[model samples]
Target: MFCFSCCMPQDNVNQEPSTKPYQDTKPLASIANLSLKTDSTRQRYVAEEIEKLGKNNISADIFTFHDLSVATNNFDADNLVGEGGFGRVYKGRINIQGKDEDVAVKQLDRNGFQGNREFLVEVMMLSLLHHQNLVNLVGYCSEGDQRILVYEYMINGSLEDHLLNTSPEKKGLTWDVRMKIAHGAARGLEYLHETASPPVIYRDFKSSNILLDANFNPKLSDFGLAKIGPVGERPHVSTRVMGTYGYCAPEYASTGQLTTKSDVYSFGVVFLEMITGRRVIDNARPSQEHNLIEWAQPLFKDKKKFHTMADPLLEGNYPEKSLYQALAIAAMCLQEDAASRPLISDVVTALEFLSPQPGDP
Candidate 1:
C-alpha cells in the first residue's frame, strides 16, 4: 500500500532529476524497498532501543553494525538510558566518516520474548510517519545476531518521568504542556487512522510511550503493537489480545475485533495518565482500585473530582473549562462499547478546539 502517514497524495513532491551533486533533502519514498532481514538478537535490540528513544529518525544518521558498536563502547551499561520488555537502551555517538553525531542504541537480550517481526513492524510503520509531535527514526542496523535502531534523542525523556508524584522534584508537566501533548498525540493518531494507508492502529498509546523533546513537546512512539489495517473493504482484523492491561479497549479485549477505536480506547487511558499522573496499570493500588479504568470512571464524570484527578503536583492551577473538555473527550474514547467510541479524527478536532495557543502554551 502507498504510505499515508506523512502527507496527502496531493502533496506528493515531484522533483526533476538534478544534474548537480547530491544535496540532502527529506527522505526518499522507499517504503516499497523495505523488508524484514533475519537475525533474532539484533532485531531484539532494535525493538528495545526504539521504544526507549520514544521515536526513531528515519531521515538521518543510519549506522552500520561496526559504526554502532564503536559509538556505544560495545553496548556498555554505563551509558544505559532505560529498560523495557524488548531490551536496554544505551546512549551512543558515532562520527560517521569524521562527522560527529550523537545517537541512542538499543541492545536486545538474546533470551527476550520480543522478536524480529516487531522490529520490522516498527521500522516499516515509523519510516512512513512524520509529524512535529512524533519522534523520527534516524537509522537502523541489522547484521547476523546484532540489531540496532538509532533515533533522534528526546533529551527530556518520557512524559512518565515528569508526571510521577512519588518523585520529590517531579518537574510536574504543566497544564498547558499536558494539553499540548494531548493535542499533538491526538493529531498523530488521527493521521494514522484517517490519513495513513490502511489505517494503522497504534495498539499501544500510553504515557511511557510518549516522549518529550527538549521543549517538552510530546511525540508518540513504540509501534511494536501497531497494526496496519487489512486491505480494501475489510473492516477489521483478529489477533490474540495484546497491550498494556489498563489501556486495551474492553470490546477489543472481549472480541479480538481490532479497529481504529481500539487505539482510541488506549489513547483515553493515556489521557487519564497525563491528567492524573497515575500509571495506566498499577499493581500498587489498593485491591478495590487495582483496575485503573474502573477506578477512574467516576472522577472523570464529576467536575469536583476532576480536581482530584489533576496531578496534585500542578497544585490545581489549570483552567477548569479546558480540563473538562479534555475529560469529555477522554470519556467518549473510553466507552465500554467500541461502536460508542469517537473516531480519532473527532478526538483531534476536539483537541484542536481546546489546545492552548503559543502565549498560553
Candidate 2:
C-alpha cells in the first residue's frame, strides 16, 4: 500500500544524511545529548512514515540491545559468520514464537556509511515484503547508536561462497543445484519488481547477497539499497547511483536513472558468474579476461564457443544444450541497451525450465 509518489512527499524521500567521522575531541555529555536527540528524531520519523504508509501493523519484532548482545554471546569474534563494508554478521540463537531458532545478527557499525537512513529503509522494506525467496526479517534493534538486524540463518551461506570461492572441504555446486538457485533468486527479483505494491528496484544484486539454506534453496538478502520505483506514468526513478561495482549496469552507472531493467542487468552479471565460476572483476586473470562481461560478450555471439564459458569445475558433466540456453538468457540480460534486457519474470521462466526435474537431487 506504500506508494512512494502518493504516500510521501517527493522531497522527503531518498534523502541521505550527511555524516562525518566521529572526533574524540567532542565532550562526553555533548555527544550523549546529541545521540539521544538523534535517536528520538529517528524514532519519530519512523512512526510518522509508518502511519503515512499505513503499515502500522508491521510484523517485524523489536529487540533491545541487551537481548541481541546476549544472543550473540556478548559479540564474540568466534561466532562471526560474515563481514562487509557495513558491519559484521554473527551466528546466534534466539527464541522466536515460543521456539528456539538460529539467526544471523547483523550489527551495524555506528561509524559506517550505512547509517540511520539506510537502516530505516531496510527495516521498512523487509518488514512489508514477504516472499519465499526473500530472507525473512526476524527483528531489529535500534537503541541509540546500535542498528542491528536479525534474519533467518542461512546455513549453506552465500552463492558466492559455493560458486566463486569454493574451498577444498566445501563441495562445488552441481549444475542442477546451480540452475535451481538461479530460478529461486530470479523469482525473488521478480517479486520485488513486479509484485511489490510500489515495485522495488533492488539496486544491489550480486552473488554474495543471494543466500542459501541447507537444501541449496536461494533467498535474496540485503535490502539497504532498495528503492521504490517510479509509479504511474514515470519512466524511471532518478536518484544517486549506489550498488556493487562490476555488477552495475552501464546505463545506471552513467545515468542515475533507475528501473526494473537495472536489476535485470545485475542479475545477468551474477548468472554469468555462476556459470563461469569466476568473479565479475578479477585482476589476477589475464588482462583481456579481467572483466567477466567483456570476456563473455564475444563468446555469446557464437554458439560453438558457449562450452568454453562453462565452469571448469563442472568437469563437463552438465548438459551442453542447457549451457547454451542459459548463456543466451544471460546475454539477453547483459545487453548494452537497458530496453533490450528481459523482464525478471521472463528470466524466472527461463530458469524454471532449466531447473532440476522432480526426482533427481
User: Who wins the lDDT comparison?
Assistant: 2
Lowest lDDT block of 10, candidate 1: 1-10
lDDT of 2: 0.80
lDDT tens per residue, model 2, 179-267: 99998899888888877757889999999999999999999999988887878999998888999999999989999999999999999
TM-score of each: 0.80, 0.86
Candidate lDDT scores, in order, read 0.68, 0.80
Compute the lDDT of residue 162 as modeled in candidate 2.
91
* Highest TM-score model number: 2
Give a tens-digit lDDT track for model 1, residues 21-74: 222222222211223433434445454544433344344445667877788888
Pairs clashing within candidate 1: 42-146, 42-147, 45-108, 56-136, 56-137, 57-136, 57-137, 57-138, 58-137, 58-138
The superposed Cα distance between candidate 2 and the true structure at residue 122, in angstroms, equals 1.1
